[model samples]
Target chain A: MTDASNYSLLLDEIAAELDIPPSKYAQAVQRYTSVGEWLCGDDNSDCMDDPDVYPQGSFRLGTIVRPLKDGKESDYDIDLVFEIKKEKYATTSKEIKERVGTRLNNHGTYRRLLKPEGRRCWTLEYSETDDVGFHLDILPAIPKTPRTGAIHITHRSGNGTYEWSTSNPKGYAQWFEAKNITAFITLEKTQKNMLFESNRELFSSVDDVPNQLIKTPLQRTIQILKRHRDQRFANHPSHSSKPISMIITTLAAQLYSNETTTFEALKNIVFKLDAHANLQQHDFILEKSLADQKLILRTPDDKWIIPNPVAPEENFADRWHENNHERAKMFFQWVKWVREDLVDILAKRSVAQLTESIEPFFGERAVKMASSRLPFLTAPGIITLIPTNTPHIEITNPPKPWSK
Target chain B: MKEIVERHFQELVSEFKYLSLVHEEPEIFSIQGNIEFTSSYSEEIIHDSYNITIFIPSDYPNSPPCAQETGGRIHPSFHTHNEGTLCLASNIETVRIFDENRTLMHFVKALLIPYLHQHSYYEKYGKMPFGELSHGAKGIVEYYGEYFNTSNPIITLLLLKIIAEDNYRGHSICPCGSGKKIRICHGEKLLALKKLKPNSFFVYEYAECVFDGLESDSIPTELKSNYIYKKISNKNVWQHRSTTHSPTK
Candidate 1:
């Protein structure tokens, strides 16, 4: 057909390839559910009352893209919040963290799967097969008072000091869900039918498909942007300063206007972000009209602010002002790269030319997989042009003169 | 209107496969994405694509959708405005084509695709395969001249006056100076033009043609009225008159 369709189709294919496989999703659910049972099951006498384990972050949002490590697709990171129903004043942050770690160590399989404790979570690594696997990071927490779905999780600073950090993963998820509702409603039925058709052995009917499995355009847009970020920052000297997934997800969801396709969603989001980047390069003033709606903001002192929608106090860009605004600089630079690589390249290119241009940005494997599906490449030869016998549209009326 | 827009989007997505609904408002609905096409007559595989955004007004078939090139490949030097608004076809032709088939699909197939094809051909061959019109008021005069099949600007102006006033008289003499009655001469063409657009549209076009002809000294000074002359002297008219077609790239 045309370059517009070809470019978008290729991007869609790449995103589909990057998404977490069905088997892994099922395994992640089973593994985490068992962890929840062990923590609060009746068999364990030391079990706390009403402890719960549930997914958070990208897994909950359905925006998980296969992360990259050293230019190779790596394991999926499944984040779970193992929140215990207790007052924050009941115990110290150290106690809650140790309690969860000790409980996990109590299980034979978990003890074997467990890695060293992280800054905020206990990591459980699963074995890799066919170069694909996933790991679970269980963050030990207790509910924060007054606010629903807000929790105070344990954190260990670089100096090995333990403290409490407030997070509202559940509240954030609810907000994201609200933003995605419009597109979700439009695509849910069609997505369910397709899911059921593909997984006939697992699903009895379209109605049996889980709501969590149906991805809206917002989710797909986030996944695609995350992958672009991953590849853009891979092996860079300032890789640690790359824009985080939280910031990307928050901005994308906030700027989303219920666009019905990933390409449109992404183009609009980046177009606005590029505008902000251009402004940031100059005066960095907050326009009065855009002040309330701006996704990325700046303080009076020129510090970056990308506030968490659910937890207003928690700034997703907390580290953006550090190192002479290195994070902010890189974030804008990445936005520029995205505009050039993904959006601008779609203009005036053939399939082969597009493939070559995207290879360096999205990685060779992903590009190859995406290009392999193109019908143009699959067709035998150039001889397969529109047959002469086929009826073609004719311009019966004379051509008209055009003006501005 | 919403149902119609939704159906149009679905049909577009089914064919283009990449275009997605980008915006939906009470007054406007927009779809943005890439479209791929191959040259019909080319023996070799010549694939090309463009990124476009189409804005369909709520009035829809009554007021045709506007398409813009978002790819940054086309410049104003091509048949587009500086802001990338494509000069797809002359206003009258757009109206006539839409009148024949009042569907977004027909608009894309008949006007949008061919316009894009012309660009592709021009970019490769350094000349527009389909000849182009001049810009601004000059283009309007040229379009009417060609439509009425006459080199004389006065005759074309007279024909437009009849359309603008809705004063077609079959018993009257033809404006072409052929010494024949209007019914047997340009009557069919005039009637067809009358159906394509409202009288106000023709009035604007008639005024535009007069303004251009007066500027070029083709029309006599006696024909210039105080109202027309005063409007033509305005800054907006000068701005419209200043537009010149860029040389072929």
Candidate 2:
């Protein structure tokens, strides 16, 4: 019975039927933003003067496919890169990659990611049918200060997590960027033509053209966001802690060599996400319904995917940042409640409370997905509050043992 | 709690305790709840013609409270409008600004009685409920309005929104150089394509959304904002005490 335009009737009815708490939605948004910020490297972007490059969207928005015939599944491959520009992170391409590998480890069941393997990096891909698949890719650039001929995105590895042969791939990407050129050349030992370029000119396949060269960071971000919303997510679970909003803001904040940022910049990005129109027009009203859970929309049989909804508060990431601890606590309190309820629901269906069990709810066709998760369970940069034996503050029944 | 609900709760707890490699549960922040509605009314109350359940987490200060409907009730809005998910904006907007330092007990109490009873149609045509608190407006309808569509296959539509949002919210940075908001910059176009091609699938979904968003020409150079470049950087916030210690320079 909302007085709003009723622009999305479907969303209204669903919310009426499900009736999730307001706090749950806020917490979900907060969690999504937290994951996104870490992935992108900045948790705030609402105050950005210009938000297009750093503008907002949802985790699912990261996965819209290209307009082409074959580019349906993976039009863009983007990962949440945290402190990626830090010298400590980029110190050695190998070290940066190894760190990413450790951060990305998820019980080791899906495709493996070798931070910056020889030519490409591999990570886990969740599949409803296949259960799991190998997602191998490489970043656009790597640490090349001292190393040459490093590695590419997709590198098969018998080596360690994200470990590449001593060869450096950063040299090539950097070389291409500096020269603003592209080339299709066999990777010395491999005969495969690895298209290298700063611009789109170097694409070899008719499909690889990137549609355009030097896509605005916003443009590039759009593709990344679209990917998360596409039908493929229904097909599998990437299970990343990285949320699309955070990643977009981070890229926007760091689009240039010297871009400095604040929380407002990130919030601007969230607003952009709210304006999207992939879902049924009626669903527009329920934009926040999608906030609570890490979602993937699947038809009854789990094949087709409806369009994704965007977050309305994308332009408001900074307002929350003024009080990070407070915001986190608020977000987590609701999530824990929801998690308890969801655990009950999943238990009835015989699903576990751990991540693996959370799938049925996300994958369900009646997919009104919200979760009550342990907030600090697997965040990339969040510091787990562990108390030492100093006894500085008396501890009465300490909380349950912390998550690993 | 009834046996079934308790069983369900136990099942969920079990999953949290056992998530494997593929499926992972969200991290739990804290657990606490209030009997505000139940204590005040001593029973479930229907406001705006919907039954609601209120629940809180253990980490009351660190986490926000949650309330959801337990009984099944079909909502009216599902028949119209294409934005299928619930439009729970104000409610989310309210609690989204929660401060752990502030006692949320009052805020939590507001959600059930006066909040739900007050001007109800916040999402409807031209009705604006004045205040930062959306105790009932958010959870009452917005949550499902987007995902549950009576006109189309529910799952297909949900998938589209999830994928699209995932793409937008999942990334660490925008691929585009402009600083404008992504939704205004490229959101409509991506969703438009998704609506246009329901059966169509993608290899990397967001990548496709962007390619199509850009190919369709929604991205304009003028869309870039002067504030964008500055916003994404990890710079100091105005009046933040952390500025003294952050020393980005």
Top candidate when judged by DockQ against the true structure = 1
lDDT of 1: 0.76
Where is the poorest 10-residue window by lDDT in model 2 chain A?
A395-404
Root-mean-square deviation per candidate: 10.9, 31.5
lDDT of 2 by residue, A119-141 (tens): 33433332223221212232322
Q: Against the hidden reference, what TM-scores do the models get? A: 0.66, 0.20
Count of backbone collisions in candidate 1: 10
Q: Counting only residues 3 or more apart in sequence or on different chains, how many pairs clash (N, Cα, C under 3 Å) in candidate 2? A: 274
Could you give candidate 1's per-residue lDDT for residues A30-93 as a string of tens digits?
8888888887764554437788778999999999988888899889999999888878787888
- What C-alpha lDDT, on a 0 to 100 scale, does residue A272 get in candidate 2? 30
